[model samples]
Target chain A: MSVNVIEAGGLGKRYGGTWALRDCSLAIPAGHVAALVGPNGAGKSTLLNLAAGLAEPSAGGVTVLGGRPAGSRAAADGIAFVAQDTPLYKNLPVADMLHLTRNLNRRFDQAYAQGRLAELGIPLKRKAGKLSGGQQAQLALTLALARRPRLLLLDEPVAMLDPVARHDFMAAVLTAMADDGVSVVLSSHALAELERVADYLVLLSRGRVQVAGEVEDLLASHRMLTGPAADAGRYAERPVVHLQRGEAQAHLLVRATPHDPVPPGWEAHPVGLEELALAYLREPGAGALPGPARGRSTQTSEVTR
Target chain B: MDIDKEIRTEGRPGGGDGETAPAGRTGAGSPVEFRLDAASGVPTYLQLVHQVEHALRLGYLKPGDQLPKVRDVVAALAINPNTVLKAYKELETKGLTAGRPGQGTFIQATLSQVTLPELAGLRRSLLGWLASAEAAGLDEDGMVALFSSALRDFFNRRGGSAGGRGTAGGETEGVA
Candidate 1:
């Protein structure tokens, strides 16, 4: 069996008294592409940071390659983390960046890195800042991929890419994954891309995991139904993720089963991962505090003064 | 069971004489079969492309089997209209599938000449994996076991029905 590459257990993070994330648990299976998605301040980046050992969790912990995230040589060498905006030296050329990364990383695959850069027709001497946003993202992606890491963590890796560039980047990612069998966990706002590429999904809202599972399982567990209000309670116990009521017709998002029978007068339709994520985020009491954390935000603000 | 529901009905804008059927399946007198999973990581268009390619490879989709229209796919899959167009456009670019205005897309006359570039891509991918496998301390037996189990799982997921399967191992034949 392929090894489990990454796991987060009851992961939580707080900034001062404000909890950015709370009680999140998920796993990235070996050789699979998992996408983490949510709204602003939803703790996606925070989770990535925690997993990469760049930040410490306040309530729980994570592991990479069966080791703790912090200072574990095996975990550090086996995983590669690509941060947002992909800050790079403005004066550094593409070759320079690769060389620096190679020097710093023991598992770096120099030939593969060079080959990927060549495939994209990027000039070796071109400065990082001189390249367009799409090109920079590509360069960053190339660097991360060249490490030949067992696990890859990317936060908003494609957010800055244009449509064509984004498509190319995704193709490159898939090609690499297919070639190396590397596991990936990419956090992105590109719902369409996630829909097309993600094998597993972890939806975070207000710093908590609303849902996480394989793509097929997640889709099977949620469905969209349109009908009158009289039968609203018919699917009440189906873990209603989201609901909308109209004058004559009401739209309800129900957590479904693959073999669940269609309710009377209501036809079930597949809901995309993007729609399901939004539904989870929009649910009331979804991000509610566990205990006294609700009033602590103001107190923390006062203390910072 | 309702694979034909999403076939497109629109005739090519500039091409004449709308052919109501998908090209690869026309005049074969054999029923065309396709399976599309909405939850697959591969894009729906690519999935459709590969399905048609697989049919061609298997000879089930002869040169002129009158494939379903794009609208039929949209209706059956409940997918957006543009995605179907994109898939058709991609197929047209590859020359394996064609679209004539007023006429729907069809299999190009030379549909079986799988391109050299495609083969080279497959080779490169396999070589890369082999290298990584070696680096990761996996042996030939491990590789064989992994692939074997994966294929077994695939067959099981496909419900163990190898219907209309040809006796010949056609996977490696007639390729560049």
Candidate 2:
């Protein structure tokens, strides 16, 4: 088995009285892009910060590349983080930004950074602060990618980019992933974008894990059951996540088989991560089918050709 | 059975034993149709979902239309399979597509209720955009003007309006 690039055990954090992340345990395999998703204040940022060693966990612990949050130089060099704000020296020219990063990081890929900027047609002499929102994101991402880090934690990296820039940024990420075996954990409300690139998903809500696993397996396990409200009791044995009961019909998010023998009057269809996420956040302890086996065990080959 | 090999085999054309190729084309048209936009705050899968949904709504696809298999889609689009699956799953949840075992995927004949969850997600994304616009010092009027101007520019760049507003019959024929 491959080593886990990121591993959290009983990870928990609290802000004054409220918990930010609690009992959040997840293992991200080496070289995989895992998307951390949830609603606002869902502890996504906290989890990322802890992973980056920017913030310490209040309860359990986090291990990056088989070491502590403040791991050795090797571990630290293997990881790079792009915060949600896309923080950068606004007055610094794009070329200066690249030069600074190259000086600071031993693994920085200066040529890669310069090439990325050229491909995107971003002016090298322009200051980061003066660049458009989309250009700034591209610059920041270029910096991170140039480092050739083993694990990259991006917190809403594209939240500020324009449509065209967003596409370009994602394309860059895909290219990097293809060329190198870097692992990524991105937390964003942009579920659609996350869905497009993330191989795995970690859903957290109110500081606790709601779901985590391969997207395909998760899709296979969860089904949107549509039928009469009266049939709810019949499916008590199946794993259900959220339920919406109308006057005559009922809709349920159930963990089920693709070919499960449905309860009489109940129709089952697969649920996507977006729907599962929405239902998970909207209603807690609502109608979710009970099960600890949230991770899908589908065999997936390496993406490399 | 080797699933990966099976998938690859299905992706190719002209491999069968001298069967008459269907239609006027030599190979399968590009089934994968999606792109990730860095400038847009909306996520990639959401863009794909909305675009695919829009296409379906505009009658670009019909019942029993086959969508590109998830694997083919990711490889062609250079995206994560999870995202395509997510979008496809969303459509499935909405009853817009049906997963027919061993038959790839097909569009459903009718759609069910537009679930509240779908609407809520859209609202959240729009709200995020609005907040950013607000931070950029764009007021309500500025926001409206920006959208209208952007829309006009987009239309102009595309070589003018569909000639006339809301060409209903044209739209019914999948002109959008």
Off by over 4 Å in 1: A68-70, A284-305, B1-50, B53-176
User: lDDT tens digits, residues A208-292, model 1?
Assistant: 8766667756675567888887777666655465788776677888655536666778877777767876777688354332111
Best candidate (score: lDDT): 2
- The candidate that wins on TM-score is 1
lDDT of 1 by residue, B27-95 (tens): 232335334454454556677777777666545454444455654443334333344566778766655
Chain A alone, TM-score per model: 0.88, 0.90
Q: Per-residue lDDT tens digits of candidate 2, residues B1-176?
A: 11122223333354332221111111133232443343344555676666556555445555656776665454445475456667878777756667878666666642212344675777799899889999999999999899789888888888896532322222222211
Q: State the weakest 10-residue window (summed lDDT) of model 1 chain B.
A: B15-24
lDDT of 2 by residue, A1-305 (tens): 46777788899989899999988787777766788888789899999888888887889988887664644567678888999999899999998998888888888877888988998889999889999888888788889988888788899877777655565566556656655667788887776555557778787777777777766666666678899987766666545567788988999876666666666667777666677778877875532222233434322111001
